[model samples]
Target chain A: MGIPVTIENPKPEAEAGLNDLVALVADGMARVNTTILSRTGSEVAMIPEVANHLIASGGKRLRPILTLACAQLCGYADAEGRDGDVKLAASVEFMHTATLLHDDVVDESDMRRGRVAARIKWGNEASVLVGDFLLGQAFRMMVEVGSLRALDILSAAATVIAEGEVMQLTNAKNLETDEAAYLAVIRGKTAELFAAACEVGPVLAGRGEAEQAAARAYGMGLGIAFQLIDDVLDYGGTSAELGKNVGDDFREGKITLPIVLAHRRGTAEERAFWQRTLQRGEIEDGDLETALAILRRHGALEETMARAEGYGAEARAALDAFPDGPVKAALLGAVEFCVARAH
Target chain B: MGIPVTIENPKPEAEAGLNDLVALVADGMARVNTTILSRTGSEVAMIPEVANHLIASGGKRLRPILTLACAQLCGYADAEGRDGDVKLAASVEFMHTATLLHDDVVDESDMRRGRVAARIKWGNEASVLVGDFLLGQAFRMMVEVGSLRALDILSAAATVIAEGEVMQLTNAKNLETDEAAYLAVIRGKTAELFAAACEVGPVLAGRGEAEQAAARAYGMGLGIAFQLIDDVLDYGGTSAELGKNVGDDFREGKITLPIVLAHRRGTAEERAFWQRTLQRGEIEDGDLETALAILRRHGALEETMARAEGYGAEARAALDAFPDGPVKAALLGAVEFCVARAH
Candidate 1:
């Protein structure tokens, strides 16, 4: 052998775990997909066209699945056939979809979910307006559910998510960003929404505060782990795995944990390279490859994944309060699957 | 005089009526303004900066004033000092401000309320995010008031507003956009918010459905009138009076009633002129003057104002069910003031 390089293989168990969670929520998810499709319709044809471009392009409805699974775990049966959980789950997805649309526009992203972004197909104007349309529809659904507590959690999450995006904007291309700052940004943007999505389920079921808190904690940990894994994948993963360009974070100068660790553990010359490529946005032909090499040499990706594993462990622990049922196992497995995606 | 042109002078009574309404809602307006300022704060500096750039640059607070006036008219005394109307008024203003920020970005506007737009100063990303932040905060405040009805009304209005905006985008630069389509667009974008704002006041007061309907009717009529006057002023009003650059709508080839009326009534030659200037977006120097001359020749501006007057009459009639009081008179006067702004 020339070099005997170590290879990390994809975990079948991780994929199976995700599938189990999906299967567990299949019935509710079907209704959610239907609700989403029907609600995106408007007299203005462009609204639905733009919305469906992203919604129809599959992104793995992880957040809504979490909402539904959490609701079921909390003993929600819809005895009166209110279907509040279904509506709330749909609302969660809408909020997530709205943020994705706006994020694509903000990042000037070209592809999302392995297809041309809505912003690219329809102009940025349509992307922005349709994103607002989805967000408005999300709140309307929440109001229909008639739960002020759910509204409070989701709306506050929306505010924090916006703040996180703004913070990310400010941190973009800034090589001095530290790990704490990186965690703060991701917590606000990513984890907050996950927490809200999970918490709203228990609120809908009228579960006790302990159950809601457990679900919220689990989601928060899972989300942090999810984002960390995503950041690592942006460097180490393949385009097929990501369903988008692999080096988008690097190309966009998006500051993330991997970049932060790499910058911190780098030499003076490497730091200067990052400043030139990211801060000043000057990239040569080999800049991406060079960046990857630096990250590899510093073991930044592995270290980031380590942090993700830590969060995943916390997520698994958070579900300990629930009875040992298939739903709980699936939720815990979600945390494992999220972390193992890096392999 | 060479032509003995008819002159329309500004009405002092109309101005006085607006001032009277403003004075009546002064106490609540102050609280609303304070709430707006405080709620815009975030740890991310860019959010408050972008938000304040619009909020402090003061567009007339007519929407919130209507909310307050309508609440007072419905016999809402805030007996327990809940200040639901105050919070609701602030929320209305926030929604309005969020729409304005997004609208400026969608239109790619350079100036708003006599100040440089937030998008221009901070870039479109920040503007869009800040707008979302404000909208999230709007719903949070509505939720805090514990009124699902208010949330329903406002959320529905937001969805309609987004649809209207999309419709308007589709109609832009299209000479085939007729009066009915134009009316639908404006009613969705502008009138829906006004109607919801007025209706929420009654909802907060726990008034009867008829009172809520009447308030909504008044708001819808006034909003249509207000938009018509704004359209008329785009070509005829002064820059100082409009607080923005005149001819922006023409420069953007935005389809409005005046353009529709002028195009519908124009000869073949005039239609070609409009097609070149508006439909093709090939505006040249002196094109605005030519457009104004064409509007005057067809009496489009006057006819538009006459239509606004008719809506103003309907708005006044909507207030007929309420008892005669300073608040009711002030609300009616506010309608007259909106229509009179064209002069």
Candidate 2:
């Protein structure tokens, strides 16, 4: 009592809806994390250093969690007490991490996940090669799981993701990019992996085509919603909350939904501002604030959030194929969490 | 007067030894080329543009030819007239092409196959992403072949290649890198894929582990010889013969065998030159000539060629397990061709 006892500040509550999904898959994710760490090891020291910088960073393991939850929903059971889902979950993470490495290099990004990007910390050469290493390791892990169908799904997803990235590159700073084109790009780059991650789970669980389709649809819907929110947060949220600099899309002149919507709806003068700052790469100091103000006035961020909610609702409905359970509830909660990130 | 059509310059006789192997695999190679063209097509036009720029360029296509030759040596015959070897051959080429793309970026190489590198013509971002697309497509084609064992072999080779690339990166411009380290780097980057390419052929042909081992050993030995010759040609051969500028390795300060040998065998003064030019990146005009003189003074290039001959002999001896036939003869000749390139 003599010592002025002070209690540590109460720990901030975990992100509301995502925490539920995270808690539900905590056991599976532990196994996945173990697999990820073990598989990323190489005699080449730089590989694990670069890969773990991103892998061990605190981004939500949302995609792998989807893989685990989908497998559980499909009633996956293995006699040897070794589920292929764990390896597959790790594989999913590797693919994601590999893409992130390449993306940072492509975008010349300085920060990622509230930390300096691997490409910036390491060199671009290291980032590119390490990304390739992780991708190779990902395929190796998939082969070990011995599921041809799963491999097909994931490999095809990878191809689509690459195609999407190139498409996005072509679309960057092009104000003429319409919603349909934007959707195609995001579906290729982002949604395809989510779809594959969810689809592989049911395939490994020995579930039939119907369940697989349901899982894929759910993942696809949720992934689109997730990306839409990401675009919104790039303009509407803070770096501390987003784990990336706010208005990074604007800085990079990346034409996302907000930019697409705003440009289409903007007056000639406002469009000129976008063209100068984004298209022409003549960004001035106050441009991000101007971009944000333009986005708010036009309600572009709100409309994007609305579209995300629509996709989230669809993701929720896709899970109706399975009986209501903790896994299913958690999956639905994850979708809500993705959409709610805008707020 | 019969229009004296000037007879086209008599086609230079194909390199004596490699021509035999190429002729043996010509029919299969046609199918493989078709598969490659069809597989690389994407709705994203830049992918095919960048990919075909390399694939359609006049490189020897030696690796895919090895896959086809090994399958024939294993007496692969598919009843439906659809040999998985064709697809596997294409997959092997895609992997090689993907590696070439990434390597060009990592090396900042300007010329490849006597043409501008795709990375320079397009951009590093496109090169990285398109290389990824090709890798993904390679795996997709492997999965279509429905051989999990083949997938395992190739995927493992890919991981090793990436690790080797990283190892090479670490070794670059570092004078302390020794011959053992150099060999390790090449084995990981070069021989592993060759080993896998040859190993998968017998696996697809339903051969036993012994035959697979023989094929793998042959490919491994041949691969080492091939890379040694490549390293030699970089210094000793002409730009037309080598299809890349001579002294590129020296300019890049790459720590290959010649540099390693010369540095190790040189006098204190010579070592200082190497340390200043390579280790410290203080290369000056005429540095390449000085490097060449040092290498020649130590007989480094000749010793490297001798080493290639030794490996080529081992590669040839590996064919003892197969009956004496055209395929065996062609394979042996191919090894000789690899070594003879040094001349």
Model 1, position B191, has a per-residue lDDT of 90
Q: What TM-score would every model get versus the actual structure? A: 0.97, 0.96
- Return the top candidate by DockQ: 1
Candidate 2 chain A least-lDDT 10 residues: A1-10
Give the TM-score between model 1's chain B and the true chain B. 0.97
Give the TM-score (0 to 1) of chain B in model 2: 0.95
Q: Please identify model 1 stretches exceeding 4 Å from their true place.
A: A1-10, B1-10
What tier of docking accuracy does candidate 1 attain? high
lDDT of 1 by residue, A85-192 (tens): 999999999999999999988999999988899988988889889999999999999999898999999999999999999999999999888999889999988999
Candidate 2 residues B120-197, lDDT tens each?
999998999999999999999999999999999999999999999999999999999999999999999998888888
Task: Please give the range of 10 consecutive residues that has the lowest summed lDDT in model 1 chain B.
Answer: B1-10
lDDT of 1 by residue, B1-343 (tens): 0111232334787788799999999999999999999999998999999999999988789999999999999988888887899989999999999999889889999888878889999999998999999999999999998889899999999999999999999999999999999999999999999999999988888998899999999999999999998888777666655667668899899999999999999999999999999989998988888888898999999999999999899999999979999999899889989999777
